[model samples]
Target: MEWVFWGLAAFCAGLVWFLLKIATTIWRKPLQVKKFSEAQGISGPPYRLFSGNSTDITRMTDEQNSKPMALSHDILPRVLPHLHQWSKSYGQDFIFWFGPNVRLVVPHPEIIKEILSTKFGNYPKPPTDPLARQLLGKGLVDLKGEKWAQHRKIINPAFHMDRLKGIIPTIVRSGANMLDGWSKLILLGASEIDVQKEFNDLTANVISRTAFGSSFTEGKHIFEMQTKQMILAVDSFRSVYIPGFRFLPTTKSRQRWNVEKEIRRSLRQIIDARERTAITEKSGRYGDDLLGFMMSESKEQRRVNVKSNGSLSTEEIIDECKTFYFAGHESTSVLLTWSLIYVTRNEKPETKPFNGNGFKWKLALRNGRLQGETRFTHRNAKRCCSVAFLPMKLGRLSIPAGTQLEIPILAIHHDPALWGNDANDFNSGRFNEGIAKAAKHPMAFMPFGAGPTICVGQNFAALETKSVLAMILQKFSFVTSPSYTHAPLLLPNLKPQYGAQLIFCME
Candidate 1:
């Protein structure tokens, strides 16, 4: 009994000591970061224990999101209130806490260029949120170093311009299918449709067909799982990263874990089945298409490399598939949705637009680059200034090792000094003169990203977006629905909180 009592006391003391150590580590790390930021003269919002500046950020975000805004494209303030306030207060180069992590917000193009290009290796992609990782997988987006290099090499064939062109018919068919649904719905009169949903489904179907060589019906479960997991993951980013928190049996955690597990299981079965039946001979043409490309690459890499750690595993291939779905589907859909909304609202009667039949419309679209504005930037996490200053110099500022940096795209995009007075307006004509004349700096407009690590699927995304928009434009003329609210909220991805409701009429 005495031994038992002593054991209990010892256990309690050890637990207390362990917790104290963790607490100390957490408290000291951020302070150390803060001290480094201050020494570098990087000012930011005041820091709080554990939560850091996120509480204030959350408060501001909540307050901003709680209210609806008038129909306008200037959504930077509403979407990122903290960044807006900090930009005004501390100027461009400022530090801020994203939960417990200290982030130096670099809005200047020169500094941004240095971080993204000049010091490319120094500013690797920041660690994704654990919850987000669960959903997104350790695919190319999540990986870095040698593994990333290998994955990029293997995946390159899949997104080649030639291969992308092959998928154009699939894209057109998917868009037409969506328009068919809309046609039936709006048969009576002009229909108030959620263009966001329409584009999402369209993009999803397109990606499904393109990636898997199978229709949406086959990959619907995987799509659904990812979509649900993404919602939960986005919510998790609002708080600090707690070690082993994801392992806890909390409802959200459990849901995420279950979804992740199901996604893996479903993908495994699909892959296994795909492996069994092969219509194409394995002559190393990336199997047949995109899905085949990924699967073939993974297998061929394993067979040849054998011992190399660079080659992706079976699980890794599954992850890449998940990443492809979201990466391919989500961004394109958002661009299309925004394009439709803006075109409807900003339709100019003055400009002698292509007023002709479907064939003429197709000819015009095919002849020129689709002129549309995509101001919104979708970055998972801002870059962390964690890299050590090798020779002790980044521009005029001396950045210390372990310091974090965040490149606020929203702030840079809407800067009146950079984009001029009409920066907030949805002006697609800004790009008519080319990117050189678009903004003060070319890096100022980074919708797809900048530097060497710019989005690999950018061409694919652009082509897909143009195709969808062209189909929609050819079919109908759209205007923002009266019920549409211009509340651009950030659920990690910038989206219309109330949905992009648009009224479409057959042209």
Candidate 2:
């Protein structure tokens, strides 16, 4: 018995030492590596071996807040200090390391335009983690190459101007319903409202009605699961990306797998039910909601395949349906939320409204809505409208073929040089004349992105935003509340860090 006890103690000691060694190695490995320096006209920090700026990126907010700065000045730095500082130190075209990978920060409008247009195919999407892929599925946002092309081809017609106009009533009706709910909440005298959540619900409803031809209450289960999966996927990124990290039988991985299974099962049920109903009815009465269009397209594709010896598999159709549901929902919600924040911050009070002439001039100047008078020199440039696109030649830079270039839309919209001193100011009047005259560069105001891969649901999103905002504006006045945090953080999409708190007084 004494010999056995001694052997067990020895085994435990050895295990402790082995675990300690592994921990030490992980701690010592560098998270980022800077390949070049700002002094050399290369962007970002010098890459550390393994971590590649991960430590600084993670602790950015804490560090930025330790110093004194204006709220606006500190906003971007607190969230993405590396990108901000690097953009300043290195000229517009520079590269930075992000955890053993180089991310080229293309800040110039011309460079951005080139990436979005001329050299589009050169930069494919970066590889998403297996967990992310599982959660998001191979949606249009996640797809690349031939797969993406196929998705674009099949779904493009659904977003055509005519098809979109058919869905306007759906957007308007949904917006009206949302406004009625808000009215009831206001009547209860709620002091502060979280506009972010309001928009989420409103957009969710819009997506459900417009995409699924059903109420959000019906699709709430699927949306909830997707939301959970997104949160888990983002959290899982903290773990080291070891070889086959995804395949490892870890608790988090297993949880994600289970969540994904649930999502897939739920989605399959919805698709199956819709197909069965379509089959039994004989008449197509669902109209142009996203699912209806997709079903119609699938049927056509099937017929074609039968005639031509090939057709899209049911699995492919299901995947596309899932993609539309996710993308169509999330992107529209984010855009509407941000647009609301912008309009609220910029709108002058009713008492302080500018005179008609002044208002017209301001609107024209802000958005470049007025026609003609397009010529201008760099130095003598008056405040042109805030929205404009310009064409320029961008010299070539080394971009790996498969690199997924992220066009930081928010960053571009808020760029100082392009938008003058008050670039960060939220002024919708900047879009008065439309985006064309807003900036010296035409590509500056790409809210829905530009080029071929621009969001397919842009019109639908716009109609939803316009309808909701119009309804809200007609009913209540919105102003930023004291409880509102100014932090605009990106959790896959840009959102208010602490939620958008606003006061709603009856109009």
Candidate 3:
């Protein structure tokens, strides 16, 4: 009986010791990081225990997004209220906690350049979380080191300027198809159309045809599943990063898992079919599409050395395909939508054909450029998950090792000091002088990212945008619908809350 009592006492003491260790880790780690940040003269809103500054961020974001605001080009506050507020208080370089994880906001162009252009070994993509891994997979965006090098080499040929230029007609054809639908709707006396959805469909179709060598219908299911999964994944990001949160059988978790499974299944089917066709078919039409280029390159890699170090497996290829679709589709659609919104607000509609000669056509393209300049509608140029193991000189300070940094793109874009007092205004003329002189820093205008790892499909996206917009401008004149609201929703990207409602005067 004395032995049993002693055993119980020992067990209790051991449990207490274990709890203390956990408490020490949870409490000391963040404080240590915070102390390091403060030592380097960085400060932000004080963090709370365990939750850190997440509650405050959520409160600020929810408050800003709850109400509608006036239609204005200065939307930095609406889209990123927490970052904007903190920037006002803490200046360009400040510290914030992503749920106890310390992150430094390095908005200064010099620092951004250092982060992006430095050796990949020193500053790799920040360690991807489980949620990100589940959604994005280990694609080029998430990969690092030799695997990244290999993927980039293989994917480079597919996005060559010549290859992208060849797809111009397909973009025009896709745009024309959407316009045809709009015409039929107009005949049925439909005067109003949500151009947001229209553009989304158009871009998705463009990606489907260009990347997969398949029409939109053939791959629409994959897009649908991915879109749903992305939304859930974005929502999950805001939650506290507790270990094992993803493995729980919660409704959201289960749904995300199911959706991801479906996406992978669909992508596998598409890849399998393409591989079979490549083997069986004699036509060189396969060379015309991105999938063909990738597959061909991958096959050649295998032929040279079956144990080649750089070659990607079938699963990796599928991840890359999904990455292309997600990156290509939503961003281009947002760009087109915002372009139309800005034009409707700033310029008068033209009834005549816009063949690059019409006043409104030129005006539209200029506004498109401005829209790209001011909007953080797509992936910001922040080096994701990148860290320094040893102290590195960043501007005035030696940034501490293990410091996670993100370039505050939205903050810099709207900074009056950099872009002048009229930075907030919708001035396409600013870019007329070209991007070189648009801002104080040459790297200020990074709509398509910058540095060595800049977007591979930027040229393709640009040509596609130009062709589609030119075709649309030639067919219709449009104004913002009466019901249009100026609420910019940030679902991991800046977008309209009620959609881009437009009254199209189709001719």
Candidate 4:
């Protein structure tokens, strides 16, 4: 009885000590909420201990889909509705607590520019959630300071206009191949198609061809693993606000780890084969694909580093490759998908001009394609050309250190003040004329983002999108299917929550 009592007391003591250590470690970590609130000039209710405002944030996010359907204008309303409401109640720059942390939302374009361009170094990507960082590895999107600078310098030449132009034929070929596949399906009596899935496959193939200089069939397994990884990665983002959750041996974490491992293994094999071929054949001239270009550039850097006593390790190269796969695949696909949706939704038939607008119609469709057609409505004539000056002008917006600024691009693009009353409506006709002639604020439309970090594959993406759309439009007329829902969600990038479904009719 005495021995039993002593053992029980010892166990309790050990447990208490463990708990105290954990509590102390957590309490000592710097709180993120106070600084964030001060910078944004707004405050919310006091945070709950341990949980902070995590419960409220989670509840708000879950209820987001319940909001009444509205025109898909901006993602801000959907992605952060709680923040949107708080902004209205407080101010444009408001601070919202998420768990134990607070994020300052800055909506003004001037402030956005300062954060993105001027003081970029101050706000690094928050340490990625452990699971996500493990899966994604540190790439340009996640890199900061000197690491980011080094990667950017080495990779910059790969995106030069000349290098991009060399891949145009590859882009066109991929689009044509996908279109051919769609035609086969249409012949087999499939009128309704999942355009989102089709676009995904198209982009996947394009990336594989342009990045690997090999058939997508060869890279099919890699694409498959990446697709799974993307879903898992997105899921991790939703749940990541919960502190220490990633370290647990949860099923989600295990799955993510496995997927990441597979992707890395496949990439390593591809890299090894390429290196061997370069060594044995063609006297080490690298292939012209994006991956090949990256390897070639990395090798040059490695040579320089060896001569100068500074070198990046093999792990760093692998991290970069992973980054390329994620960034290159996802962004281009989303942009192309959105562009297609815009074109399909907004395409209007050529119409005869109303009395005095005869010249407008003549200029609108030259050589059976939409070209430069500028018109000056009585209200917009003076402001039309003035729009061109916006991007170059630096407006007054003070930015403090360590502020993470987001370009509320969709908000800017769809704002009634910037784009007139019909801003929410899709109207590519607005761009048929030079953008400067059509936009009330030329800086507002930033599908490719802006400044030095704008997408490297913008031209390739545009050409591919045009080629695919042209081929599809020539053969089929499309209408929205019943299964289509307009619930836009943000997974870092905006996407339709449900797949885009459309009915296709053979022309």
Candidate 5:
């Protein structure tokens, strides 16, 4: 009887504590962050308790997602309606709330250069959306300070020009295989096909071979699981983020967890096999591919963690695999898919009149083959962001720590002030002088980003994209399919809502 009384009292005490904590988070902290921003001349859509701007965001996204857009190059309105609308109303560097957290939108190139340029000394990435962290792990994209530097240092040499050169043949081979499949499809009277889907498979194959020494077919299961997890992570799993809601025994949650577990298990097998082969072969080396580079004894040089041999933990190595495949594979695929969209729509593949972009090749079909040079648009017009871990001076404003920041790459890319009147139009001719000379600001055309955190796989992706595009051009000429719907939306990266459907005619 006495035990029951104490138990009830303890239960009441815990319930009170939990309620107080929620109150502080949902009400108190938001007021502090909002007040701090208002003092610095920053403002946005007024914050609503618990919901903040999430309701507005969800409403806008739902509206856009309901239908496809017309075939046009201006994608900002369709892809990121929330950022687009708010940036116009609140100026380029205003603040908004994602739930209780105040997010500062930073779109100007002058300021973008400063934020990404610094070491993780002051600005570190915001805590990743919980679902995303589960999908990608705490790899390079999420790691901070010394740990980031350590992992990056070990992985750097694998992307060196020399190391990447060794993989060019692999890219070429993979592209050829994909092109062969397209030829067979054309022969079988399937002239109208989705190039976006094809490019996704092509890039998957490219990354698998480079990262794990396996072809897409060899690691198809692994890629499939990661794909499912990425979709879930970016979709409803990240909606509004209720504190204890995800841990609920929901059907969707269980499925997501199962997929994630399978991913780690599959990756472990590959790494273990590679290590065993290295030991048995007496080569004292893992191959020269990315994984091989990470597993090498001499490569790391110093012990990053307190492991026996002073190398990266197997877990760290696995996380990086997820990052490279997710980041590199997805971005490059988006680049190729959009490049196809731009080129096919151009109607002319010959040299466009050079304004500033040196020489230009619009998509032209001659003698049943594509002529002229092939270049890929790394220009994502993408959206990603970071947070201020400590108070830092951003241009004129002294932003405080805990400031969440979003760098609107898409908005910056298409801003008329930066890219002239034809900013939104599909003009690959802009890169004629090279990316730097192509835009008003040096950081303006950053398809792969800039500064220290600029994508290490940039060179790898560019080469693969060109290689694949060139091969496809040699094989076929494509135009927009009549059934195609141009609905470019960001599933964390710019993607066609209905998939990039195009019609391939014999070149």
Candidate 6:
């Protein structure tokens, strides 16, 4: 009887302790952190019990996204309503919570420089969530330390201007094929077209052929799976993230897993076939495509046995492929879509073929459309786990570990202080002297990203946009259709929710 009493007492204490632990983690610690940050002059929406600011963010986002926005360059409020609202309430640099986690938004340029530059050592790239890991893998964006350096070195050659220029003919060919279909439609009295869909298919076709060579069809299927996987992963992440629960056999998880498996299997087959070709070919070359550059470096890494450049394993290669397909396919397509919107809006439909110095193109990129938040689609950005890895001093404040840092690209790009009074309006002349002089600070114009880790495929994207748009301008003139609705959706990136409808006029 005495032993039983003692056991019951112990069990009760254990249960109480467990409850306390949950309470402390879910609310108490976050409260303390909030107080400390407030003491440091940083304030945000008051932290809630467990959901924190996520509910507020979701509400604001849902409400804003529920309607059709007018055609204007002032899209920051519609796309990132939470950030737009909070920044107004909490000043330029503020902290917000995402499900009990503290996220610090750094919008000042000096601080952004500190975060992205040499002090980059203090701030590491956040880890990818389960689905994002499947989407991007251990590619350049996710890699760190020597592994990242090695991968960067290997990937450098593929995206080099010379190499990118080599792919120009392929881009022109792909664009021409898509345009030919559009021409047929115009001849058959289909004057109106959804250019958004056209660019999506065009960019997809371009990436498939350029990245995979002879295996483009297989690459397209793999990218399609990744697209489905991204959707499932994002929908699941919109709710509070559970640490180990993603492994369970839930419906969404099962869907994500199925798509991920197909992506991996398809990518693996394509990679293996490429490798076999490299081995069998008498020249021992992997061809001049993106995959070939990595494969060549991989072979060299194995041969030298240096271990310093780091090893590129087979799985790593697969991840890189998925990353490339995801990033390359969508970002370029959205860029082209928005660029055309500005082009058709600002200039006459009969405007001549776009030149390198085309004001509308520059305005599209410079006025916070492409240049604002091209990298920020895919609402699962939280997976990057952008928390402070350790207690670190940022500018004037010393933030604790687990404090997430966000460089709000959209906020910075649309700041009136940086770009004068017409910040939200399309001002192509602002960029006449060049992007550096366009804004108060050069870093304000971060379309691809900033720091040592700026987007590697920027040249590819830029060249493709120029080639594809130039080809279109030469073939047909287009005006915004009356039926077109301007609803910019930001869940997976800034996209036209309805579709960018344009009425094509034969040139």
| Top-TM-score structure, candidate number | 6
Question: Per-prediction TM-score, please?
Answer: 0.84, 0.77, 0.87, 0.75, 0.83, 0.91
**Which lDDT value does model 5 have at 205?**
82
Clash pairs, candidate 5, are: 348-362, 349-362, 349-363, 349-364, 357-432, 358-432, 368-507
Instruction: Write candidate 5's Cα lDDT for 304-339 as tens digits.
Output: 444634457888888888888777887778777877
Off by over 4 Å in 1: 1-36, 231-243, 250-255, 279-287, 299-310, 348-392
Clashing pairs in 6: 377-493, 378-492
User: lDDT scores for all predictions?
Assistant: 0.71, 0.60, 0.74, 0.59, 0.71, 0.77
Better of 3 and 5 by TM-score: 3
For residues 99-143, could you state the per-residue lDDT of candidate 2 as single tens digits?
A: 544455666678766666676654445665566667667767677
How far residue 215's Cα lies from its native spot in candidate 1, in Å, is 6.5
Off by over 4 Å in 2: 1-40, 65-75, 214-218, 238-243, 284-287, 304-312, 348-406, 426-432
- Deviation (Å) of 417 in candidate 3: 2.2
Instruction: Score candidate 1 by lDDT.
Output: 0.71
Q: Which regions in candidate 6 have their CA more than 4 angstroms from the true location?
A: 1-6, 231-245, 250-252, 348-364, 367-371, 375-391
What value of lDDT does candidate 3 attain over all alpha carbons?
0.74
Q: Deviation in angstroms for 487 in model 4? A: 2.0
Better of 3 and 6 by TM-score: 6
Off by over 4 Å in 5: 1-24, 214-218, 231-241, 248-258, 297-310, 348-392
Highest lDDT model number: 6
- Can you tell me which runs of candidate 4 are displaced by over 4 Å? 1-41, 44-53, 67-76, 215-218, 231-245, 248-255, 303-313, 348-407, 427-443
Error of 2 at 67 (Å): 9.3
Better of 1 and 2 by lDDT: 1
